[model samples]
Target: LKGQIHGGVAQGLGQALMERVVYDRQSGQNLTGSFMDYSMPRADTMPDMEIFSNPVPTKRNPLGAKGAGEAGTVGALPAVVNAVLDALAPLGVKTFDMPATSERIWQAIEEARA
Candidate 1:
């Protein structure tokens, strides 16, 4: 369960911060056709996570257990995005898009300042 949660969170982090599919505007060709052109989350990029499980009995299930599949991933993406927005709130950065790359962040900051 722990491994599943951790892996899901890693996947979520990648989607939220690093994963983007780029295409050529003129030719409609895929720009990020391979791993070399794509970015994924590495071990060094992952944040330390502390997980706590609160098991609640489900009335609909005979086992009284709720599935934890994709639980971490489902929350992780928005959590990370919200965290970044919160950090930049003081800078008047009210909105941001996905794959919150450093370049995009800098652009947001600059726009806010302007």
Candidate 2:
């Protein structure tokens, strides 16, 4: 269960920071058709995760089982986005678009300076 939670969190973090698909706007053609073009987070990209859980058993389940597999992911996505935005707040970067890639962050910084 602990491992499952950690894996979920890692996946969620990857989606937030490093996962995206590129496409050509005019042709609607996929630009990231291969792994070489598409970016995914490697083990080095993941942060050290400390997973903690408080089990509350429900009578609804016969065995009193609770799911923690996706809980880490569900909460991590928006939390990470908001954290990035918060970090950029001091630079007067108020708006955040999706993916929030390095280029986007740099652009936001430049725009703020302008």
Candidate 3:
């Protein structure tokens, strides 16, 4: 479950900030078609993750426990995206769309600079 949280946070960060599945408007070729052409999530690109457990068991399960497997992803994704936005807020870049590609981030940075 912990690993799931960490990995999902990392993936969601990439997906929300650095990864994309874009295709060319003219030829319909996916801009991220190849592995080499696609931006991927890497450990060195992220910050350390810390998970806190509330231990307040839920009513949805039989073991006095809620499902942790997918819950971490459900929760961490937002946190990661929000963190990115917060980190970039000083530059007047407050709003962002998903798959926050490098192109997009760079554009926002440029726009902020302008």
Top-lDDT structure, candidate number: 1
Alpha-carbon runs more than 4 Å astray in model 1: 43-45, 54-67
| Candidate 3 or 2, higher TM-score | 2
Cα lDDT tens digits, model 1, 39-93, are 9987787788887877778899788866677777898899999999999999999
lDDT, candidate 2, at 86 = 96
What's the number of clashes in each of the models?
A: 0, 0, 2
| Candidate 1 least-lDDT 10 residues | 64-73
- lDDT of model 1 at position 92: 100
Each model's TM-score, in the order given? 0.79, 0.77, 0.62
What lDDT does the true structure give each of the candidates?
0.88, 0.82, 0.72
Ranking by TM-score: 1, 2, 3
Of the two candidates 1 and 3, the one with more favorable TM-score, higher being better, is 1
Q: Write the per-residue lDDT of candidate 2 for residues 47-70, one digit (tens) a residue.
A: 887777787888998988877767
RMSD (Å) of each candidate, 1 decimal: 2.9, 2.3, 3.7
Residue 57 in model 3: shift from native, Å?
9.0
Candidates in descending lDDT order: 1, 2, 3
